[model samples]
Target: ITLPLSAPGIAFSLVLVFLLAIGELSVPSFLRYPVLPVLSFTQFAASYNFGAATAAAVPLAALALLGVLIESALLQNRVFTFRSIGRGLLISLGRWNPIAAAIFGLLTVALVIFPLSALFADAFSLTTLHDAMQRAGASIVRSVIYSAIAATILMALGFLLAQLTRDRGQRLVNFLTLALFAIPGTVLSIGLVRLWNSPMTWFIYTTPALLILGYTAQYCAVTTRLSLAGFFLIPKTFDEAARLSGASWTQRLFRIFVPLSNRTLVCAWLAAYILCLRDVPIALMTASPGGDPLPARILTLMANGAPPMIASLCLIMAIASLIPLVILARVIPSRGITG
Candidate 1:
């Protein structure tokens, strides 16, 4: 019973870490490691062998698909059933309150405060920040614009997929999204290149549009899950009432569903934006010669740049990632919402 109840949360955590890890390029590339994604990149970039690259990616793609199947099997019996918040019993940590508080304080200081302190210390100078910005300003803007576009696209796609899966038993869409999420960025990039690096699709293949598609493909599963969870909170009666009142599908969707799903949409958009913003592998592989995103630019510069400048660039990226959280903090309180 407990396992079934906790399955979704566990699955979400596992998928999150797995996706992040599998798509990563810098650490493995820098360490000269033979991780799947890095190996694929090497085959393509170092040897310029598209066929070899595709062949190298086959096993990685198969493993990712296998993982997705395992995830589905584990959660097959875990239905989406939410209970009223008021139904749960609350335990007051009266005796352990101080101890719990102390533990949290220590963790916050160690995990959050300490790392941020070092970043600030290394990247504190205004001159360095300005220089960093001046040097990679275009890439910075590209990262933001591309990520925002990708996030918007993901939210739209997520809502449609979530609605389909929820009301029509089209669970295959959900499974496909999960499978796509499991694909490493390098493997996906190879497929994207093969599909588009031709005369027929030349108009799009060499453009930033390719990176946008990669972002959408890589992160749409997150938004889909978020949207599905949001759909669960909305009672079926609302839709039924709207239909009875002669609301068309479009009317019911915009008039009822969209209004109720604002928070979920916001959360999904933010999550997707952050994922795209921090991504490097997808951009590295898909971005045109001069269209590299900020993270990719940083990785490239790290090879020859000064330590302080690199640190500054990294700090800027960290701050950029926090912008969504800061927006949520301000907007949620202003709207009288609580966590």
Candidate 2:
């Protein structure tokens, strides 16, 4: 049926949205919400007790892990395989098709385009934008650099793990990533602090590397899933033929797999980049003494800054999120990723 055929795409979308949702800190902080991420953040930020913060985060982490387990069970073979023989008859709208299309178009405009247009219209002003730039310029640059580093590391590690999806350790690897992904950023940041706060690892821990590691641990599974989708699309016969031709493993991977999977790798990188750029919880918790990422800085400024300036910063972040989506849309079509 069309439902089964489309399940993987739906599941992927759900996972992406879920990851972004559970890790969000700014909105919850702003709205005085009881969300898990905000709870963890307040516990540490207010009290400075790592143990109390981690304890508060444990239940939320468990819930997230359970969500992942449920998703894995529901989406197991459905996600990895796209081919199926069952077909459902298409219901044609016939004379109403045009009317339906028009309604859909209007709905899209009302929901996505209109809200964005309003945000831009209200948020844009030279003086406010300049103020935002002055306040957030360094943080923005840091966000980009950190995101790039995190995305690169995630894509590399994810590629290796994705290649081993059919191996014996796949389930264990998947479970580990899921568990890490589920852990509240505050909890993970505290764990990282405890592990690296020691004298030996202090150098890297005190640097931006800690933030990059947090991002990688949280989002690597997303990259792995994206890369694995591409890997699965490629027929095993290509590898078999290359092997028969006496090509080395490196030769096959470089000459064949990498070239074919280029689109997937790019998609994964862009995904990770956007995740890091918009992240607040990890950025807040893992930031160095004098430095904070743009998202975290924005959250801080929003409490005290003028509404216009805050709007402008939020607008920039919104645009940052949209850019990768546009790139993915264009690249996917050109690269023939039909799903």
TM-score computed on alpha carbons, candidate 2: 0.85
Candidates' lDDT values, in order? 0.82, 0.79
Instruction: Compute each candidate's TM-score over C-alphas.
Output: 0.86, 0.85
In TM-score terms, candidate 1 sits at 0.86
Strongest candidate by lDDT: 1
Best-fitting candidate, scored by TM-score = 1
Tens digits of per-residue lDDT, candidate 2, 1-339, equal 777887766875687468657766777789989887787777788878777778877876776777677666756633352223356357789999999999999999999889778778768799888988998988888888889899999988888887777445777777788778766676677777778888898887889988888999988877877777778888889999999999998898889888888777888888888888888888988889768988888888877888788788888888878898789767665444413
lDDT of 1 at 175: 78
Candidate 2 residues lying further than 4 Å off, grouped into runs, are: 1-23, 81-115
In candidate 2, how many Å is residue 75 off? 2.0
